[model samples]
Target: MASPQIIADTEYLPTLLKLLDRAEKTIDIMEYSFAIGSATGRLNRNSAPFEIADKLIEIKESLGKKIRIRLYIEGYRETASRNMVTAEYLKEHGIEVVYGATHAKGFCIDNKFLLFGSTNLTQQSILKNHETNLLLNDKKAIAGFNKYFEFHWKGGGHGGVILPPPMIADGVFKDVLVDMIDRAEKSLNFSIYFFHISEIEKAFIRAHKRKVKITGLIHHHDAFALSYVRRTRGTAERMNDAGIKDLHYGPGTLFTHSKFLVMDNKEVMLGTGNWLHEDVEVHPQLYIHLKDPTLATNLTKHLQKTLRTVKRHRKEYTDSISI
Candidate 1:
C-alpha cells in the first residue's frame, strides 16, 4: 500500500497526465465540471483542457478494447453549451460520456490508483485555481471511493446504504463539518470557493466564541465573476464581522477552489463541494475527511503559504479570475 500523495494547483495537471499515461486497464473520471477552448478562460495552444482530452482519445484509439475509458460530467445548464461540446467531442473519439447532476470530482485508474478532491478538469482549474487533490493507491481507500462513486452512478444505489468513513455524501457534509468545528480546541483554517452557508457560518461563530482561532481564505469578488462570488460574500463577510477578522480574500488572479478545513492541526475535511449553502440535499455532493495529523499539518502549511501570497499581490483583487 502506497502512502497518499498531496498534489496542489498547477501540479495537478502533470500528475493527472502521468497517472493517465500509466493506466493500463481502465480510466474512470467522475468530474463535476469540465470545459475547453474559450470556456476555460484565456489560454494559448498548449492548454490543459486540450492536453487531457487528447490523451483520453489517444488512449482509446491506441489501446482500443484493451482500455476502457469512461467519463462522467455534471450537466448544469450554465455549462451546458461547452459541456455538451466536450461530451460530444469525447463520444466521437470513443469515450463513454455520462451526464447527471454530479458534484463529485474523482478519478479511478485500473481499480488501483485514485485521485480525488477539489480540482476540476478545466483550463481555469488547471491554470489558475488554487486546488488541492489527494492521490492514493491504497486498496481500502480505493474500494471505499469506488463504492461511493457507484452509489451515485447507479441512481443512489436505489437507496442503498452510504459507504463508511472517508467518503461523505449530501447532508452528511454539514454534520461532519459541524462536529469538527465543535471539537476544535485551537484553530480552524479554511480555504473555500463559495461560502454563504449560514449554518456553517453559525458553527464557525460558535467555535470562535469558544476561543478557537479562526483564519480563512475566500476568493474576493465584486459585481462580476459570475455572481457566485457576489452571492457568497454576505456570509463570508458576516463571519469576518462576527470576530473572525482573519478571513482574508485570496489573490484575484487565482480562484481558491479548495474546500478544506484544518481543525487544531489534527484533522482535515477536504473535498470538491463549496460552502455555498446548508441545503446539501439540493445537489448530490461528496467530500472526504481524514484524521491524520500529518495530513492536517501539511494542509495547514499550505494555507499559510497561500496567505503569504495573498498579502504580497495587489492587482485589484476585485477583478474576476474568469479573465
Candidate 2:
C-alpha cells in the first residue's frame, strides 16, 4: 500500500475491502447515500457491499460484542433504497445507524484511521467514475475530521429536506473562491466540469481583471444537455479572454469529474459538486475548504499529469487522421 498515495478509480475497492476485513473496534461511515446492492444494479452490475449496513449487522452477530459500528447516510425518500431497513437491521443487531442530511463521504476505523475523498463507497462511484480518496493513519487528522463529523451528526445533518441557501446570498462556493483568490496573490488554479453560474465565473474574472493570474483545467466532453452546453461555452470564452490560461481537455477512464480550485499557494477547494447553477439549485452537494498546502500541491501535481495525458491522447487521434 502506498502511503501518501494516489490511486485511480478502480484501484480503491480492493484496498477498501482489505481495510474493512482488518477493522476490529469500530467503524463510522458517512456518505451522501447508501443504497443496497440491488439498487446499484440499476446503474450498473456491481455489488454495493461498502454500504456497510448489512456487513455491520453480520459483524455484530459474529463478534457478539467485540466490534462496534455506526453508519450515517443521507435520508432521501425520493429514491428507493434499503437505507431505513439497513439502519433498522443494524439497530436490531446492536449496531448504531442514523440517516439524515449527511453530505460527507468517508469512514473512520477504530477512531484511528481515516478515509476521505470524492467517493461515496457506492457501486457507480467505486466502479465507474474517476474518483480519489486518502487513507491516513494520522491521529490529529482523524481527530479533526471526526470532530467535524460529530458536530454535524448531532445537529441533524441527516435530514432529508434540503433548505436551499438564499438565491442572492453569497454561498460556500463564492466564499471558497474569494479565499483562494485573495491568498493566491499571484495565481489561481482551477479545474471543474461546469461553470454555469456567474457566481463561480465572476470570481475568476474578478481575479483576472484585478491582475491576479488565473489558470484552469476544463473538461472537453459534451455530455451535458444542449441547454447546459450553450451556457458553459459562454463562460469558457469569458474565462479565456479574461487572461485565464486553460487546459481545455482532460483524460482519464471517464470524462474529467474531479472538482478542485487552488488559489495562489494557499487555499484549496475539493468536492463532488461543480461550479454550476444546478449544483446550487437542485443538486445536493458538498465542498471542503482547506488551507492544506500538502493536499493542494498534490492536487496541482495531478492536474499537471492530466494535462500531459490529454496532450498525449489528443496527439494519438490527430496523427491517425486519414490524409
Candidate 3:
C-alpha cells in the first residue's frame, strides 16, 4: 500500500473534514483533551470550523439509531482539563461516553479508518498547536487498534475498563524502548524533541552492539540534549570503535517537538510520546505504529530533508542529517 499523503500546516482540514463527513456507521474517539471554545486567541470562536461536540450531536439526530458514537476522555475533573460537557451532551442523544484515567489517545471510524496523532482533538491542538495524524485503511491494522480500544472500552468504568497492572504501572518507558529495539530488524531511525532516559540510552547501546543501525535526532534547545550529548558520546565512541556508522541528527529550529521512529523502513511510530525520562516514566503518552512503507517512506523523506539542514554541535549524533 502506498503511504497516505502527508498533510501539514493548514492544509489538513479539508481532507480530515471530508473523512468525517463520509462516515456511515460509527465514530469512536479517544482524546486526552477536547474543547469547543477558542483555545487560540486568534479565533473569535473555536478554531476548527466544525465543533466535534456539535458533529456528534448532528450525527445522532440525523442518523438516529443507526449511528453509534463512543467517546473516551481521560482524567477526572480538573480546572483546565478537557470538558466532559461534550460527552454529557452526546449521552442525552443516546451516545456513550467512557472516561479513562489513561493518557493514550486513538480513534476508529466505522472500524475501517483509523486516526492516530499528536493532537488531543482540543481547540488548542486543532487550531493553535502544530499536530500530525495518520489515516490507515488497512483492515488488520484497524482491527489491532480497535481491539486495544475495545479492551479499554469494556474494562473502563461505567462504559469502559481501566488497564491492569504492569500495563498501567509506572516505569514502562524502559520496557517500551526495549520493545522498539527488539522489534527493529535492520535499522532504527528515531527523532525526539527531548531524550534523557538512562535506560533508553542503554537500549540503544545494546541495539548498536547487536549491529542495528540506529540513527537519532535530538533537539538542541531541549535541556535533555545537554545530558544526552554527554551520555551518547560514549555510545558513539563505542560504535566508532566497532566500525559502526555514526548516528544522524534531523535539522530544524532549536525546537523540534516530534517523537517518531522508523524501523527497517517497514514501520513508523508517531505521536505525543517523547523520549524523555518524564514521558517514559510518568506522563501519559500515546504513539501509533504504522506498518506500511508508503506511510513510513514519506515520513522518512521528510525527516531526511530536515536532517540535511541541521548544523552539528556534537560529534556523536550527526551534526546534520537531511530527511
Write down the TM-score of every candidate. Answer: 0.90, 0.72, 0.67
lDDT, candidate 2, 1-323, per-residue tens: 12334445677677766677678888887777555544434321236543445556666777767887777666764432655544554577787766665556777888867676667655666776656666667565566566646655675332222223211111355555655665566767766766677766777777777788666666544444557656766788777776665536453234555677776655566665666765665444555555666766776777676666666676554321110
TM-score of 1: 0.90
For model 2, the stretches where C-alpha displacement exceeds 4 angstroms are: 1-8, 35-62, 77-95, 137-144, 151-173, 209-213, 219-233, 251-253, 277-287, 315-323
Q: Best lDDT goes to which candidate?
A: 1
Error of 1 at 238 (Å): 2.3
Q: Who is ahead in lDDT, 1 or 2?
A: 1
Candidate 1: tens digits of C-alpha lDDT, residues 1-323: 54367899899999998999988988988877677655444333477887888889998999999998988777764665677667777899899887776777889999989999888878889888888888887676677778877766665621244757777766578778989998999999988888776778899999999999998888764436566777677777677678887777766667788888999999988877777663365666677788878888888999898778766565555442211
Sort the predicted structures by TM-score, highest score first.
1, 2, 3
Ranking by lDDT: 1, 2, 3
Number of colliding residue pairs in each model: 0, 6, 18
lDDT of each: 0.78, 0.60, 0.58
Tell me how candidate 3 scores on lDDT.
0.58
Candidate 1 Cα outliers beyond 4 Å, as residue runs: 1-3, 38-45, 157-161, 223-227, 315-323
